[model samples]
Target: MHTLRLSDEHLIGLARWATDRMARVERPVLAERVLGVAGHRIQDPRARADVLTAAAEARLGLGHLPRHLTQAYAAELQCADEHHKAGHRKAAAASAAKALILAFHRVAHIDGLTSPLATDPAQFTGPLRRSRVLRALRAPRGRVTASAAPPADRPMRLLLVHSANDNFLPVVLDHYRNHPGVEVRVLDTAADPATAPLAKGLGRMIASGIGIRSAYAGQVEEALRPHLDWADVVFVDWCTAAAAFLTLVDPGTTRVVVRLHSFEVFSYWPHLVDFSRVDDLVFVSEHLRDLAVAALPRLREPDAPATHVLDNAVDLARSPLPKKPDARFTLGLVGLSQVAKDPRWALEVLRVLRRQDKRYRLRLIGDSMEPGVSPALDRYRTAFAAELAPLVASGAVHMTGHTDDIAAELTNVGVILSTSVRESWHLGLVEGAASGAVPVVRDWPFFADRPHGAHSLFPRDWVVSTPAEAAARILAVNESEESWLESGHEASEKAISTWGWGTVAPRFDSLLCARFAEIPAQRRVRTIAE
Candidate 1:
């Protein structure tokens, strides 16, 4: 485990060589070498910035190795911060812009690879980037005027803004579409080809923490002005680049709302979004809110957006389908496309259960781990493949890759298992419970030791510390068909009552219709002044 050390000049030379190699031949290994030099060996800020930027640019062209890109991104941002503190504004802006562009490439690459259950990157997105965002956003921006609030008699025009991810929006859309009091429209930035460049430019501006009157800002204003004018409120899902970009441009009189899931908190996107521009901030679970607040102290500031914790809306009307007789031995886990899902943990639980009763089996429902997304995921996938092959061959494990009808699939599953390393909320597990399946959740490692985590999220008896405990719970619950069915019935009732769209719709109504009543009087005055 020897670390490679190189002089600053040699590092620059190696970086240029790697970049050329990457252009001619897409070799992720060469990018890895450059990242190693940039992240570990380089000492001079200028040399480090050049090497990291080269590595990131080369990788962007080749299109892989998000971990390497993330490393370069973090290193370049640090360089930018150092130069800025030293009053080298031009150099700082250059490094910051490079880091920002690299981040855009990294986000696009990783986003194309997996579902929402993706794992944290190799390096955490620390406060360095947030410092820049704070500096940029310290200036007062226009907000929804008191006169712009929608009248109570007329329908409230609502707009849904998303950056490609619409997993949770369909339900919200359908609910609002049918309601007589609301009119909804969608603006998916990723789906629109025209705004892509503008989006990138806005990202650079935000990362640099300078530039408000740039052409990109004007373009964003031109593109979004119609939506801002048409909608009374804009709900942006995921505190990503979209949220950041929206905050940069003044929304004439439209109220802004942003929702944060789990993974965004671990990335720089959260750092880019301006809470001052957001009227409401939503988190799916309290634990995720706690994690987000800890990471971004701005969320806890006196003038910050009003925060709310709401359960993800799940459609459970069709759930609790009658289970097959043999379902008692079938364990289910949904979503394996991400490293965070930890399918191998489910396999271990299956092994433990099968050792006691050979009838026990596990079914994985979702896409397989994507290849060549990031080195960390590739390593995890390689090990997972090794562990899973034998089990699959022996017919003890089944991978039902990417199904549209999850409810139908869950009907054959008796015990639903949440074997994730981390989650804001285990949507699949809740869905399975609503389908009359007993739940066995692993104490999600990322937040397990925290005051409010998986242990607090779910019933204590439903969550376990290890595969053995999960297996024991499974065995005890399924000791008899009658007892298992009864437990599953109770689980179904709870899941439906707690997270079903019918139960959660009222909360959404409150959020959308309450008209900023939740904001403190002083905070309201501050928001108006800003």
Candidate 2:
């Protein structure tokens, strides 16, 4: 199952069938459903090239597709990547769609092909043997190297690595950026010229995952060597290509910690990571840790690193300002964009409340849906948009868009809603709660009955299973101005006391500075974010 290869004769036969099928069609379209005689048509130039490249590989009995196909895939991925970096999210999504379509075309019409996703985590086999090369490259544990920890009093050097978004790094960065005892540098592989190839080199990543070393491996080794050398501790933000890239090289003596926030548990990257090289593997929640462990059987091996659950840093010092009497009517949802946020659920709650009281308006804070990320996302966005159109026109909802000053916006919101279907942490609701907004967290369906979810993260009274329950809670709490203020104040006090940085920051400080031996293992991952 690990070797999902199609033989040359098998591939050639499929291609011939597709070719003949295309010849028979009166009108050829680009859609996935528009099959040629065999079952699909290459609609775009990139996909067309893929057909030729795949045919060339089959004809020559080559082990891989031609260079042109790989380059085309990498270039398209980079194009989408640039859009994401520039905050042209919709445009970025559009570009990524093209890349996905081309990738699909690469395997079109073949048996066990047509679907546009990767194999399930359990399907892919990991390292079969630590070949001679692996033995030579691996850095043995507990050995002293040039980057070993410095004396306790010396400035501790830290390098933060990010493969994509860095939204969660602000707390860590702000704390150490100018610390007299620490030197910190951030490297975003998405932007770094040398490391950027590590991200965009689709062919390289594939070849390396299957135990083959290509030029891209040398490029990554060269690019990351200096940064790894300069740091006493390397904290890679996500379990992604950056983490995989780091593990490919033997870190002389630096402590490497990789944090798996949430979605990466379902991605292919975690399987590619060589756990023996990592000293610490962190997760924001326990459920995600469980799923990740289940997906990759290797984590159970003795070589797996020590695991820790670290809460995301939230600056809880910002005290809540007094709210006006009318603030009771405003419900706020802080972040949106991905389909997972499910703003439509929040709108449903708004509808339930406004049936009796029209003043119950919703303030939607964050970016509108970006349809370019995937076809599924685009469909969800379209459906959600249709549902929201009438409400926006009727003034029942206000799309405030994204903002730099979230604290200022929370002032008018008495109720903060977490309507997400899934989340590793719900930072928006907690931030709003720190500002004295009553939190109404949905029982996140992804882990509702499973261990460690919104239900376990917050007080039972703060969580609801449906829009009706959320509406009822809102109605009961906001019956009078006194009742609303009293509820909001209580929620605010609990959020800061339990989850605020005042309580959480010290844990992080201890984590970063403590000797690896001091931190306990298999601890529950906790976050007040959701």
TM-scores of all predicted structures: 0.82, 0.73
- Candidate 2 residue runs with Cα over 4 Å from true position: 1-148, 522-530
Candidate 2 lDDT over 391-471, as tens digits, reads 999988889999988888888789999998777878898888888888899998767867678888789899999999999
Error of 2 at 484 (Å): 1.6
| lDDT agreement with native, every candidate | 0.74, 0.66
lDDT of 2: 0.66
Top TM-score prediction, candidate number: 1
Index of the highest-lDDT prediction: 1
